[model samples]
Target: MADPALSPSPQKHLAANDVVSCNKKSIDDAENSRENVAGETALVIDSAAERALCRKFDFRLLPVLAIMVVFAPPFALLGKKIGPSRMLPILMFSFGSFTLLTATTHNFSGIFALRFFLGAAESAFFPLVIFYLTTFYRRNELARRLAIFYAASNIANAFSGLLAFGVFQIKSDLVDYPWRWLFIIEGTLTVLFAIFVFFYLPKSAAEARFLNEEEKSLAYHRIQVDSSSVVNEAFNLRESLQIFKRPSTYGFLLIEIALGVPLQSVALFLPQIVQRIVKNTIQVNLYTVAPNITGAVTLLILAFSSDLLRIRFPFICLGFALTFTGFIIYAAIDDVERQIKLAYYATFMMTWGTSAPSVLLSTWYNNNVAHEGQRLALTSVGVPLANLMGLVASNVFRDQDKPKYAPALITTASFGGFGILVSACLGLYMVFDNKRRDRRQGVKLSARDVPTSRLRDGPKVDDFRWFL
Candidate 1:
């Protein structure tokens, strides 16, 4: 069969120097605009009352607003049609441009409009990356690779906090306010990074420039054997709709919602949580680094273990267990000054548990779902639907519920507990289903059987068995 319109070309090659030159040009083009935005934000922030700005706009805009504009399933479907390598860089550049524009906002309307665009741009990214990665690696290898990929976010978070700590100290050199520099510097770097992603990332292993032809064939054939089909299935709505008929799709979505609440609450409100213990702004940012670094390490270890055991549910449940324990402990502690050290340790648990489930849950769904279009549709809805729970987190942790923030902590822990139950139920269902299929084949659990019409459906095909 001929390649699809968005399929990658094996012959489209460029030299390393060309890529470097292109990135340099992109940086140069973005610099002046970044300067202008930073200057405008600085002026507006300096003139406006800071607390009033925080209350009127930042507080109201922070939650429940932009996320409603996000509809990622279509873009996930579009990535299916157009190719992720082509699609992701464009999306990255678009969001980065919006980030740069955000620095120039003179009032609530300007910032609000730009933020909506930013969320719309970002909504498709996680699902696209998950779908893209599944095409390259086998089911067993995916969790670890995704864990490694996700750790980069934790690492970036650590660095960004440290960078903001230092950058915030600059005191109006590049802009009238240091916060304006945050957007300018980060946005410019993101644009530059998008240039590299465009040039370096291959659309598929078969199109990878660094691989020998033999290596490419081996990579492609490995997946072909596993799925009994090539990665690029024909785009079809009938197949997509068929996915909704599966019980696991709804199960995975429930698990995603359960996981997303703590993940986002911690991501957005960790500093605020830490501030309850520490007095200084610099110290609060610095304190966040240790927990994030710990989370990254825990994520990698759990992922490696998941891949090593060739299992999924145990680790996901373990992660939720940890998060639940942490949130419960942190919330239970009323005396911050007396148990500050203990409360600090609880943050480590929250970070560790929250990090693993997000990566693993996605891998779990991808492992179970058979068809390309079905996986795309499920994840497109699943990933953003998970993030949409961020609205719940935002509402739970309002200004009225500060310092202890008992309401938010308790609510997040409850979700974690719910996740644990849901994951265990799903795992049990798969195990029982697999056993029933094995028994009906007149085969013992450990034995190989003669191929029959049922068996001939192939791995991940009509006769697909779930991975425990």
Candidate 2:
């Protein structure tokens, strides 16, 4: 055995070691460190098996998501009355139960029925959440918050794909198909989360459990100062009807329809589109992950920029431009197999526009609607009407268009271009309309005199300029 002091310990070696040995040891240590780090990260880069699980489902099930229109309007109205806190929990529980039940479905009818109820349960969630958010946030604060909320959905979509990639790799003793496990695990999580939501989410800023009395009061007062509108005021019928008569409302409805077509189409059919380019199901899901993440990032960037610049329509136009150009490229590239890289790039472009218009369009009306009655009507009518484009989306990409959905891509691109035109026209109208209001008042009216406490009794349309 070596003497204790002379043994090759690092301390003893350092004292006796030559400069060349010390340098060599340092190089060895760095290489060893790199090897250890690479070993630790090997699992992260190795996802080949997980991606193999992204096979297509029967197209008939597409109606499950699209059917939300049937239940959305009435539910929006109910959520307005009963409050989203009460309604959201029940809806979450209902949909989560249905999603749980979907795993056991062996027949088409069972799947369809479950999907239908899922749609019913989720119909009002988005619009109601938007309406609920408006109660607390000021107009300037809304777009960013809404973008963040919307970004969460895109993040979920990205996460779900990544989750599916991993979850499908599990070798189950009880279940024959790993696909069934997807529904089982995700559905259970949703149910558990709904329970958490029920306990955690506050009904409104005033009722928020996390905030102190002072903070809650500040929250309430800020919204008051921002819009001079009452929070959660009772709805009115005659005044709500006035929104329907406005030309701007129709313009909004038309623009939403145009935007919704591509949005829904991509949301529902992305896996299928990617499958055409990549034969493997796992690769399809893997490929989709990048575009989705890009979309979410683009959405957040646009939203914060819109808030920073105090502009909405210019971003809306930019979103449409990206969407249209993507679709146009997709349409022009007839040889998908030969031009697969370009086709995939087009998907990134298509997804960039999906969240912007929907978020901004809703906020536009929410900001301008002024009173509770008009706000509720827009939430109830405009949102559901915009969702009606889902029906068009569900039917557009026919079986004959398999592999290359040229017609569907072109149609969606056309819609995007038309939406841009409508947006421009609406912007011009808002500018002219605001000018007319200023001339009528002989000066632009200030929001100071608007009542802060009463619902449906705040500033009139002429008193506030619309956000273009």
Query: How many angstroms is residue 300 displaced in model 2 relative to the true structure, after the best TM-score fit?
Result: 0.8
Relative to the true structure, how large is the alpha-carbon lDDT of every model? 0.75, 0.71
Error of 1 at 230 (Å): 3.4
Q: Best candidate per TM-score, number? A: 1
* Candidate 1 lDDT, 443-466, residue by residue in tens: 333101111112222233323467
Task: Write down the worst ten-residue block by lDDT for model 2.
Answer: 53-62
Strongest candidate by lDDT: 1
TM-score of 2: 0.78
Residue pairs with backbone atoms closer than 3 Å in model 1 (clashes): none
Tens-digit lDDT track of model 2 for 86-107: 7776678788889899999998
TM-score against truth, every candidate: 0.80, 0.78
Please report, as a residue range, the 10-residue window in candidate 1 with the lowest summed lDDT.
Answer: 446-455
